[model samples]
Target: MSDIGLFEAIYSTRSMRRLKPDPIPREVLDQIITAGVHAPSGSNFQNWGFVIVEAADDKRFIRDQYLKYYREMERLGSIPRMADIPPDRRRLFEAAIHLAEHMDEVPVIMLACTGTDFPTYADANNPRSITATLHASIYPAVQNILLAARALGVGATLTTLHYFFEEELKQRLHIPTDKEIAGLIPMGYPHGRFGPTTRGPASDVTHWGRWGEVGQEV
Candidate 1:
């Protein structure tokens, strides 16, 4: 395990999309998944399922699907125009595009999934039937995986573009029908450096005892 402090890990973890093609060691991958499973889940059900993809064909398929959907979104005007994106964030946006184009070359792809007995909100007319809280069970584990990867010097980014063609992905990957993939994280050694993320002050968003009750900065 890394000797880095907890807060240090939390603060410096960024969505690293540009990664080297070098394969990560199996032991390191095992430790990263172990960190994910250590995270708490609703009712302690611990129902998350992870799939680590290393096959060249599988990565190529995923990359093709990602580009297909990305192009469709662009055609539909769902994605913001280049000029609309803020100057500081344009680099990140370009990095994401780079990832999409070269996703097949990434060394590892991890799918963080959850089991579902009930129909998802997308499939059902009544959103309440499948409580939004269902996601609460899986995202913490995803965050843990990201933090662990950062601490171990692996670059990873959580992406959901696959959801656009999720059924095809499930069939291609042989994921169970009962499982829903929440996040697809491509992982490997970084082509760049890990550094602190840029964000607005937490005090600007934090409310005290009640809504509109702003508190002083910590």
Candidate 2:
């Protein structure tokens, strides 16, 4: 297969909420997991772990794990704060619930874990910059996985609601408690096709130096 550029990858990927019931091959899934390890890590610590769940029993458990949050939210009634968001975002959250409600049907689930928490080295409190940087490292890996899967005709959706019950998840999956669960991405073959996507122009958000300052040409 030909090499895929970053732009092509970005354009090719969508949330892919809907997926085929067919199973993903182990070898092909391995390639995606390996791709995640290539991502940059904070201070070159390289402490990330990618967990892929494909077994029906395991996927069902993971799906149940995802439902915990929505159930948690439902018990509390309405969203926790953030009412200021437009209707679209509220709907997006609901859509995520819809997806999670049926997550057992998705063929694969990937959990990105940090393996261990960052060590503190200062007074009462220093910036948790290292942890945030570690998070930044994982997203690129997730991006590559999504892109690679798209190129192979597999659909993927990166999710995070399960993070709400990280400890419970760790216990169920036997993941280390020290590890920070970054995100959960569910992937499988698409029942639909992918093509071009519409988005805001680069000029809309590109800033030269300052937040409000735009480049002369843009």
Poorly placed runs, candidate 2 (over 4 Å)? 1-5, 71-97, 119-124, 215-218
Which residue pairs overlap in candidate 1's backbone? none
Total residue pair clashes for candidate 2 = 0
Q: Candidate 2: TM-score?
A: 0.82
Instruction: Give per-model TM-scores.
Output: 0.92, 0.82
- Cα lDDT of model 2 by residue, 86-172, tens digit: 775775565566677879898888888874555542342645765566677577778778888877778888877776777877887
Candidate 1 residue lDDT tens string, 114-164: 876443445667665555545777899999999999999999999999889
Model 2 misses residue 146 by how many Å?
1.3
List of clashing residue pairs for candidate 2: none
Instruction: Name the best candidate (by TM-score).
Output: 1
